[model samples]
Target chain A: MFITSIGYYIPDGRITNSDITEILVEDNKEHFSKEDIEFLTYSCTRKFEFLGIETRSCCSEENGDHFASMAEKAARKAIDQAGIPPEEIDCLIFSGVTNPFREPSFAIMLAHRLGIKTGDFFDINDTCNGFMKSIDVAGLYLKSEKYRHILVATCESPYDLKNTLKLDIHIENTDQIDNRLSGLIVGTGAAAMILSSDGGKGRITHYGEQRTSNDWDASMLTLPGTAVPGAKYGDTITGFWSDGRLISSSLIREMPEFILRKLSEWGLDAQSIDLFIHHQLGNNVTFALMDKLNADHQKAPVNTFKQFGNMATVNIPVNLAIADEQGLIKKGDSILLLSSSCGLSYALLHIVW
Target chain B: MTFDEFKLMVSDGLGIDDTLLNRDLSFRDDLGIDSLSVINFLVKIEHKFKFKFDVEHIWAMKNLGEIYDTFTEALNNK
Candidate 1:
């Protein structure tokens, strides 16, 4: 399936480093002394620099923005760009890292918003690689001619307090600061794409995925499934519960192998790729990946994590939008969309624009 | 989980080969896993074993043997 059009929506409310620090100090006054607060504030500033993030969008809670609303906004833009009406979409896939609830999938909710009555619905939760998996699945359906247009969309609101664990400032170990701050790294964003067999100028030439489930538990998230019947009232989500060192080590070791194997088996070389769209994990991990692959850093640009933080599965599409808006990628450019997630899931999609 | 199963899980979760996993081996030196992973692993162990380790109790363990022994101690205490 070819990517006919891409569209994105990041909430207008921005959260800066200072705002986060203030929240930390204000929320945990009993646990931290004045000096400790200063130290923690300084630490938060360093974290911003270390993670390569300056600001991130938070969905306006006061405006009553939820996943369905965000997805509707993004999907409409993509449909408009593709010049295809909502009814023409053969399939609706709510593909991403975060699905707020198991029932009433984003596809159904989004379809309702678009005033479309019918389409095959699908969902994937491979975390960060989720968007690519959706495209891969959409491609398979397209090959049969049974499906012409598939709308794949993602809206992650990790910053939504209900979806993530509140910051804990009670710990005495200063070293735990980085781990505690990780929850803040996630931001809210949405992106949608119209993919068709015979659609836009961008052609999805190759798609691949791999896993090292040998250690999938290195990261974990416990959502209260707030909307689920079994969930109790006053429940909440416990998120960003991850082992970063283990994850970074494995990603550092495995990502190169993944990249090399894909390039070799496909008879393609790294130099041929014009743009590399990767999971916005962080600057250290991402840049380390580029350096190890011996890729030109300029070509594999990493400007999104700084601007939007880690929007999880939406990172790739958001990066693509940034590249398009910045004139970094244009028609005829070869693009590589590589994704890595908490479950040790990985997917790579090659696009010829 | 048995001690062997726990060791295997550690190997599996850390992406360390089975050959490198042994009670005598230090989790830090032999596996090259950082302190954060050790804490994360200990937490996982608690979940699987249905037991909780005191903060200081988890802090002092070093090699795989100590990890196994500490849990055994917890069992004996219970």
Candidate 2:
């Protein structure tokens, strides 16, 4: 299957380092010491600089923006760009970490909002790998010839007060500071892609072998699904933890080998791929991957994390949309989407656009 | 590579003075070599030794000495 259209929506509330620090201090005043607050604020600045994330976008709660609404906006843009009747989309997949509820998949809700009459609808959660995995699933359905068109969409709002402020910020050690701050690195954004079986410019040629290591537990958001007995209403989805250093470093160490092996198997080299669209983990991870592959720096869009922060699954699609708008992609250009998720899942998908 | 040789590579790879290096120095705390840099240095070691170190072990090795011991053990096994 080939991608017919792509679109994204980044919320308007531009959040800066100072804003994050203010929230951290204001929310945890009675819980942390003066020194702890000072140290964490300093650490936030340092980490943001090291991660190369300058600013992030946050949705306004007053505007009633939630995951479903954001996904609808992004999906509508994708459908509009597809230039096809909404009825043509035979499948809708909502792939994102942040969801409005545990039941009634966002896809079911989105289909109604988008005016899609008949289609298969569901949700997939693979953390940052959600979108890529959704596309992978869509390709399988399209290959079966049962589905003519599919829309895969994602909307992540990690910066919501309920999600961010609820983090267990009672830091007992400096190491915990780094781990907790990773959750705060994410901003709010939505992205969508429309894939079709018919002729299109972008085609998924191969989905590489996914390498899953035990390191996924190194970073996680405790969602409601893992709720325990006697849990309070919001006990789940309260804690967001991550070893940002371990995750980024491990990806740097592991991705080169995994990708190179896949490239050799696919009978291609790194230099031949026109664009290497990486999951916008950070500048460190993206640039490090490029350096290890010994590929041209210009072949990859390296500044999305710095410009947009980490939108989790939304990073790649938003980057793809930006690249398209910037005239970076051309017909028949080989593209590789390198995705690494919190589950320690790694995948490299080859596409010709 | 000997501990001295590893120190030299660490100094060269991370752009620090060789004299400042020590076996007991915490890679993150003492040398200020962030986790990303430590892994990058380990990647260089992997290239030098022609073998792959366990990715998970990279985070568990807290000190320069621990990293050296693990590398030595892995290289000897290889």
lDDT (0 to 1) per candidate: 0.74, 0.78
RMSD of each: 11.2, 9.4
What candidate 1 gets wrong by more than 4 Å, as runs, is A26-28, A32-38, A61-64, A161-172, A224-237, B1-78
Docking quality class, candidate 2: incorrect
> Which 10 consecutive residues of model 2 chain A have the lowest summed lDDT?
A228-237
Score candidate 2 by DockQ.
0.11
Candidate 1 lDDT, A1-353, residue by residue in tens: 68899999888777888877777677666777777776666656654654567887787768788777788888899989999988899898887566766787767878778766798876778777778888888998999999999999998887664434453433444445555555667778889999998958689999888887666655655653333232221134244455567677778767777987998898888888899988887665676677668888787775677767888888999898778888887889989987888677777889888
Q: Give the Cα error of residue A213 in candidate 2, in Å.
A: 4.5
After superposing candidate 2, which stretches have Cα over 4 Å from the reference? A61-64, A161-168, A224-237, B1-78
| Candidate 1 positional error at A111, Å | 1.0
For candidate 2, the per-residue lDDT at A293 reads: 94
Please, what is the TM-score per model? 0.75, 0.79
